[model samples]
Target: MTSISILKKWNPRPTSLSQMNALLLRIPVSSPSMSPRRYSTRDRELQSAKLEIENAPIIRNNPGLSASVFRNLSKFIRSYDLMDHMLKVYIYKEGEKPVFHQPLMRGIYASEGWFMKLVEGNRKFVVRDPKKAHLFYLPFDSHMLRLTLSGQNVKNGKKVLEKYLKSYVGLIARKYSFWNRTEGADHFLVACHDWVWFSCINLILMS
Candidate 1:
């Protein structure tokens, strides 16, 4: 949904309206629900806490995630009033825009305006400037994570991620092999799949 539509739905603070606008425009056409429509109380908490956990060790998983990505995520989280506005946006509000002030857990937030556009840049960026995607993916981290965590819950997160990739439009990630098998495209494994262990794993889930 558009940011204006979201603003009308929640009646939230005016300060967030601009941030919401900036976030909504970056959503790629493929992922419609790329935006959220608020969640139940339990879900809100999970998303908020998860954002915190992700910011901590996310760098280790993906060395490609640059310091700027980390800075932006922390800055967003610090502004969003943590889980307070997070839950409000999920439960009381209509869309995910209210989350701009919260921790930058996922790329769905898109608060940076310019950053997400950079993330969506040419695939050449993937091979050359891998770090750019990290800033863009931070907002959608929650849903990307949930989709990955679907089947088995805790341990399932990894495999669930693989499953999600297989479902993508072109399924490039699906057609590619991660472990050196000849079944899928070599590029998918080296560029996309490895990202899971890298910082943009959550970002890829968002894409």
Candidate 2:
């Protein structure tokens, strides 16, 4: 081939080893063929935000402020940016709707349901891939569980919910290594029912 033709076809390599190293660092984590070991840029930003929060002093507290409220506010301020930019929730896709994927958006339990839908709909924070998630949200609706138990003994209803949760957790543990790895430290659920909260005790202990 002519030199001009060769030049047109030729691909330039990194000028130096250092340049190559820098280029490699910028590679995206979503590359299908390669699993990157380093933290993503988003994760790095979150780490820096966390450090800033941890070191920040308690600023401008009112005399009426309760210690608990103050502590909560402090934490919120510190982590708000991190949560907005880096938080990723992975909602499991195993279960059927109205119990798993579907949540009631009206009535007393609406908050729980609305929150789930809101988070799931927010592309900024919702990541379908479990590998990319910061938290695993168990999308089971407590209100639906209660509804499922209508006309049954209240105690039996609790047992039914507990049983379902146990099986659900078992499925997750068997299907993925995430639950087993942290003993469920990274798993969480949102529910407004007292009974539902009580039913989760065993599930939490397994973590």
lDDT scores of the candidates, listed in order: 0.36, 0.70
Error of 2 at 177 (Å): 1.0
* Alpha-carbon TM-score of each model against the true structure: 0.21, 0.67
Report the C-alpha lDDT of model 2 over 1-207, residue by residue, as the tens digit. Answer: 322344466655648756765786798844422222345554465568768777766656646555454435566665775577678888888777768878789998899889988977878878878888877888888888667655566545555666777888888889987776556756788987765544566555553
The C-alpha local distance difference test score for the whole of candidate 1 amounts to 0.36
Candidate 1 runs further than 4 Å off: 1-114, 117-143, 146-152, 169-195, 198-207
The top-ranked prediction according to TM-score is 2
Clashes of 1: 21
Model 2 stretches with alpha carbons more than 4 Å out:
1-49, 61-69, 72-75, 151-155
The ten-residue window of minimal lDDT in model 1 covers 86-95
